[model samples]
Target chain A: MPGHGAAYFGKLAFGLVVMFAILAGLQAAPRRSRKIIIAFFTFLGGLYFALEFFYPAPSGENFLTGYQPLVAGLGAVIGSFAIGLGVFSLVQLHLRTLSRLRPGWGYSIVLLVSFVAMTVFGLMNEYSPNATVIPTVGGLWQSQNAHGMFRFLFSGGLSNLGSATFSIIAFYIASAAYRAFRLRSIEATLLMAAALIVMVGSVSFGTALTAGIHPKLTDGSENPWANLRIENIAQWLLMEVNTPAQRGILFGLTLGLLATSLRYWLSLERGAYFDKEL
Target chain B: MQHASENWWVSGLVVLLSLIIIGKVLSAQRGRVPFIRRIPGLNAIDEAVGRATEMGRPVMMVPGISGLDVVTLQALSIFSYVARAVARFGNKSIMATIDPIVTGVAEETLRDAYADAGRPELFEEGDVRYLTGQQFAFATGVAGILIREKVAASFLFGAFYAESLIFAEVGQQVGAIQVAGTTQTNQIPFLIAACDYVVIGDEFYAASAYLSRDPTLLGSIVGQDYCKLLLLGIILIGIISTSLLTLIHGGPVAHLLHTLVDFLKVK
Candidate 1:
């Protein structure tokens, strides 16, 4: 039992060392060799998923299926590394801007300060105990300090800023829609008309306008001619017309995805990534 | 396993199509260059880069918010060509990605492009950046870069969602020559509305091939078309058979139509 923790730490150290060694080797390799290594690994990784999907296993319990969770765990690990790299890149760029006293260096300073503040408070919030055994007050606020600071930063600061940023889309949509809905051609006019109908039909006004379109049936059924209602017309346009168009585009996208996936999996893709000699 | 057995036909079709694509790639590699129609958006890449060079401003390339998927990879391929052009013209180019993995790959791509252009020294590490992974944050960062950097050309290619219009509209406001491409059906209208040139549907996939003009890629495009034609033929047969069965009102034609539908149906 005492050696169990040491063994686990030993394995962790070994893994980290191996990973760094591999990364160093990759960085040291020539460009052509690096690309070949990348391509070969890409093919192998893709082939695993392909086989896992296509191969029929009894009770879906195959070698790849069993290893699927491991693969996903590895992906998560890599994703964590990517996040670290992203943060590092951000900090590096901002620090360079600040040191150089660039035109927007003041903004960079603010960004760095915010980044550090958020990260520190976030970590504190995560690690701090939930029990309010030690209550500390700052100024007029009575406090559960760490959790309160994080909650204020996240809910009040981050959420509000995010919402403000997202709200910019309303103005953008207005401008974009105005330009798009311009009556430059017959097609544009028809588009605008359809847009109007759909817009109105979704509200009570359009339904009220067509409220009198009830038709009697011999079998005492609901009105068959109710399809002529503005709401019904808009529904038909969306379901029959818009849906079909979207489906057609989706079909094209699917085929395109398949073709592109094949090209990458086979390493037959023609680009700077693939065209280079190995 | 039972479900797999029921869906065997789907797998068969996928394998068959993949084989056809591989065959076309091989045949084209053996010196058979297929003719590909000009993709206007792809053709405009040079013009866009040239405009940026003339205006003495950097070109901005955003690979959308999607991670390192095939779409983003394809976008990077196009970015390689654009970066090469920018390198040759002695103009700066910036690539902003929301994913760090994409940023790493994009940096390599820009480095390779500059190397190919015989200007490896000109490659700037600061140019290709990993803007925040958050959607709106990434959009805002890119928008700031577009306006602050005063980019002359904007290239938006890859998978996008709501942020497509924001980037396109911001580029429009900056008076950049925008060439956007995406397979995102919902975002295509926004791109078309805001961009000067738009690559729609599968054209986004064909961009690398169109830009590179490689035989293998061109052949793959041709093979995709052949598959499309095959699909069209099958659709036509289904339609005609269905129509005939409807007109006959349940007979031998109906039986044949039922068989055809069953054969095509999944599970």
Candidate 2:
């Protein structure tokens, strides 16, 4: 038998050769042939997942279930390659902007610098020794390593920036709610009432508002008919009123999903993507 | 993880519904265009594109931050139609996608749309962008584009989460003609609140059919309605049976209701 290293290299070379051959064949094929091939593979892939989901097994394990890990690994590999494409697209756009020196080119430069710094530090963080393995420096310089750089950039910079961006949504939601809650119509008035009830019911102030309304009862028996509490009313509104509406919407959404999926599975979906010649 | 044995009824129902849809599609292919109600949100796509053309401003289309899925694919189909409309009127369209796979597909769809409009040269590589895979990062990037481009029209379709309002509100602030649609029921209210036109519920999925006027899609939409009617019947039966069982306090009706509930149960 060949050495382990030699065997590994042989397998790697075989995989590369197969990949290149497939790529070449795809490139050489006619557009119609390519489409047919794609459709056939799409059908096969969809069928596999569908069967895996629906097929019964006495042991609660099917043929496809046994290969689920392999399938997932394949998906991860594809996703990783797609990430590379995403990065390439980002770099291409920002580089073009910087070269052209557009009005907001400075922002593009900042984006590129951030991207490079984050990527380098993130890779270093992944490959570096754990915090336990690395010696702790004294004073505020305890983590002066690659992992620290990544943590600062990721947690301190990117995460905070993301949080700041998300915080902007509070203002937007307020504005949207303000506009939406305008008492221009009966519907708006009803919505406002519901919103007010829900908002009031969610906080401690809501309990205080109802505390004075209810008389103190000497018996420890719970009053089943007590719907006067804002919290209870809110819960009833959500569970009774909101739930039904949501269910109605969900029913429609699922039927729609089924229809669309059927269209795609049957290759009946026609448009630029389907009918147009490659 | 109920297998087919445990959930055979669901599988059977799904198969039956799929067959019905396929049959309808086949019938539609024979030149029978099914009648569909006027979907105002879909109707507004043309108006949005027209306004963009008249203003000489770009149109912005975001297919949400979802990876490649049925929702994203449906969004892309609508994007194709929008791109074609923009191409016809010599207007630019910018598609900001969060997924690289979606970006590649959107690029191809845009190119095809331009070619179909007989203006392939107008399709720009930079127009179809992959902003970021991160959710909030994608939202921020799209918001930046909406503000900077001063887009005349904004189209939001596909799966959206918390960022739905951010896009809709920003578009509203920009005073753009915003048409939004998503299968996410949670985001529907936000879109309705902030957008000029909001396609609710299944209407988001029917967008391609409504926009394209393709017979196959229209027929499928009709079949979907049929399945919905069937579901309505089932729900009515369930309600009636349960009410009768409660009122009668245990009888044959109760047994039937119990059986129906058991049959429909997932596990």
Question: Whose lDDT is greatest here?
Answer: 2
- What CA RMSD would candidate 1 show? 3.2
TM-score of predicted chain A against the true chain A, for each candidate: 0.86, 0.82
Write out the backbone clash pairs for model 1.
Answer: none
Model 1, residue A266: displacement in angstroms?
1.3
In candidate 1, stretches whose alpha carbon ends up further than 4 angstroms from where it belongs are: A1-11, A30-32, A58-61, A129-139, A215-227, B1-6, B249-252
Residue lDDT tens for model 2, B1-267: 556765677778888888888888889989888988999888898899999899988999999888988899999998999999999999999999998888888899999999999999999989998988888888999999999989999999999999999999999988899999998898988888899999889888888898888999999998888888887887787677666766765778678777876665556
Report how large a share of the reference interface contacts model 1 reproduces. 0.51
**Candidate 2: stretches off by over 4 Å:** A1-17, A128-143, A212-225, A276-278, B250-257, B264-266
Each prediction's Cα lDDT score?
A: 0.84, 0.85
Q: After superposition, how far is residue A110 of candidate 2 from its true place, in Å?
A: 1.0
Consecutive 10-residue window with the lowest summed lDDT within model 2 chain B = B1-10
Tens digits of per-residue lDDT, candidate 1, A71-142, equal: 888777677767777778878988999999988888798889888878877777766625352355667655
What TM value does model 1 have? Answer: 0.92
Docking class of 1: medium
